[model samples]
Target: MPDSTAPLLLKGYAWLPDLRRRAHDVPAVPVRLLGKRGTALHGKEAVDFFYDEKHVRRHDAMPGPVLDTLFGRGAVHTLDGEAHRARKALFLDTLKDPARVAALARKAQEEWDRAEADWRGRDRVVLFHESARVLTRAVHDWAGVPLPADEEEATARDLVAMVDGFATVGPRHVRARLARKRQEGRLARLIGELRSAGLPPEPEHATIARAVAAHVDADGRRLDPHTAAVELLNVLRPTVAVSWFLTFSAHALHRWPEHRALLAADERHAWGFAQEVRRFYPFAPFTGGLAATDTEWGGVTIPEGSLVLLDLYGHDHDPDLWPDPYSFDPARFTREGVVIGRDDLVPQGGGDPAAGHRCPGEDITLALLAALVPRLARLPHEVPDQDLSIPLSRVPTLPRSGYVMERVRAEAPAPVG
Candidate 1:
């Protein structure tokens, strides 16, 4: 079979689904990636199957370029078995707590309030860029990182650059590499300083930085400074990455203004709106790992060490899973008695968060979106004329124009008599 890497680069989010469609929507679509045999899977079953440690393993699964630019070498995403479980515990402890998630959400709201004031004085502001900086400050503050005001914008840009260039080559990819290097070096020094200080007592709130710094891995050893830095970024980077969903949320509100009033009025509706934005947008196209052993999925044998990719974008948009999948509808998530199944939405990934490779930061992502998107809806601004088009060929795509807004009104109108 011909290699699909070039096609994947060219086709972006459409690559896998288009391949499956041509194969008559088979449960397993065979292909080649980076000169390795690969099978792509979709649906809720695929999510469960892909996440099972006995079926697939993440060790050595991520490409080198990705590790260098996106997740960082030795990041939690590259572990498996007990090592993965142990490393994951760090994130689970710091990120998954209800109280902690709420605190982070509150921080984001605070940052949004401050940024809104700055935006009000400007003629036009790109919501995407502004949101990134806002998230940067909120996440850093919550993570216990001392981000000086002067360095905030540069730090946010580096974080955004890492996510932006992870999937591509050339200039963007170069920037991603440089960005990761700069941040990793900076964070590693911070970790070293904490270590040299003999590890001070953590605060009552238990920040992620302190938890990660003090964490001992499955091997019963604290992570080295570089690895510690990577873990730190694992928390910091994804939180900032929420900026993508935030921008997409803005795009959604612009295209469908009907949801704005309800989003502002109902918190639960805002949560549903956040879920829909995650489901509909093209953030992570797919995620992959290597088959742990000889395995059969959909009656097709996947040899040990073969590449396996779970189609995230396709799964969320699958008609069988979501009725009218292409349509932008938040009510599907807002049904009074309905609860989202763990495997139901694979935007970040699937499976038990505490036990598997599913993103532990998923809660934080949802919380930030829920907190900020409603405020975005409630804010008085107009979408300035620009290129609002989202190109599918760009991995981690956004509106070409970054969703510019003008005529800002940050405060609520006086109550009508």
Candidate 2:
């Protein structure tokens, strides 16, 4: 099989699906990535196979560059077995609390309301950049991190850079490395302070940072300050990354204006709209792990230690799974009696989040979007003439213009009957 690392880098999100198309739509497409023989799998059954711990493992699966840029070194993303479970428990406890999720969503809505007022006075605002800052401020407040107002934009940029640069070897990649280094250092210092002085009493709600700072691993050792900082970023960075989906939501509304009225009128439709945006937009192209042992799937043998990739983007866009997959149709999700199977949506990875390698922050992603999308729909703005083209060659790509809007105004309140 031909090496696909170059193609993947050059083609970005189009690489795997194109490969599958060329290969007569094989269930398992053989290829080489990073000089290692890898097999790519898709669909619901593939999700079950890929997430099974006995078949695949995450330890040593993520590349070093990805670790340095996206997930910090020793972050929970790289752990496996008992260590994985123990570390994952921290996220489940912090993120899975309905009260905590609701509180964060409420904070985000408040932040959006405040930001909307500021945007109204401006001639033009880039929704992507502004939404990122809004998310950063809200998550920081929720996480109990005292971010000075002056530093909020810079901090948000660093968080965005980390996600933006992880997949490429360019200036973006260098910026990502520097951002991670700076953030890890700053957070480590904060963790040290919290450890020594203990958490403050002002924030009655439980803070994720405080929980991570005090969490003991399966080995009965508290995470070192650096590791604790990494875990903290694991919470902070991904929450801020929700800005990407928010931006995509704006793009969707612009392209399909009819959905806006429905989304604004009904919160359920807004949630459905968020799910469709997550599915339609290219986020994570694929996720992979090393084969734990010899495994067979779709009549192909995956040797022990070989890389096994789940085709996330491809699966979401597969016509067999999503009829007219390319269409930006939120109704596919909002239709009455509709149910989204766990494995059917792999935008953030699939399978059981608590028991598997799937992102635990998935619920928070949905909640933040559910709260923010309707607000975006109700916000009055006009899409400016700019470069809206999303380049497929760039990993974690977005509209070149960052979805600019002009003459922003908040929605008018309904009059009493």
* TM-score for candidate 1: 0.98
lDDT, model 2, position 376:
91
Indicate which candidate wins on lDDT: 1
Error at 9, model 1, angstroms: 0.6
Clashing pairs in 1: none
Could you list the CA RMSD of all candidates, in the order they appear? 1.3, 1.8
lDDT of 1 by residue, 169-201 (tens): 999999999999999999988887777766646
lDDT, candidates in the order shown: 0.91, 0.90
Predicted candidate 2 versus true structure: per-residue lDDT over 1-417, tens digit per residue: 778889999999999999899988989988799899989997789999999999999899999999999998998888899999999999998888889999999999999999999999999999999999999999999998879999999999999999999999989999999999999999999888887887655323457788877888999998999999999999999999998999888888888889878976788887788899999999999998999999799878999999999999999998888999999888898788878788888899998988988999988999999999988988888886898788988899998889999999878887789
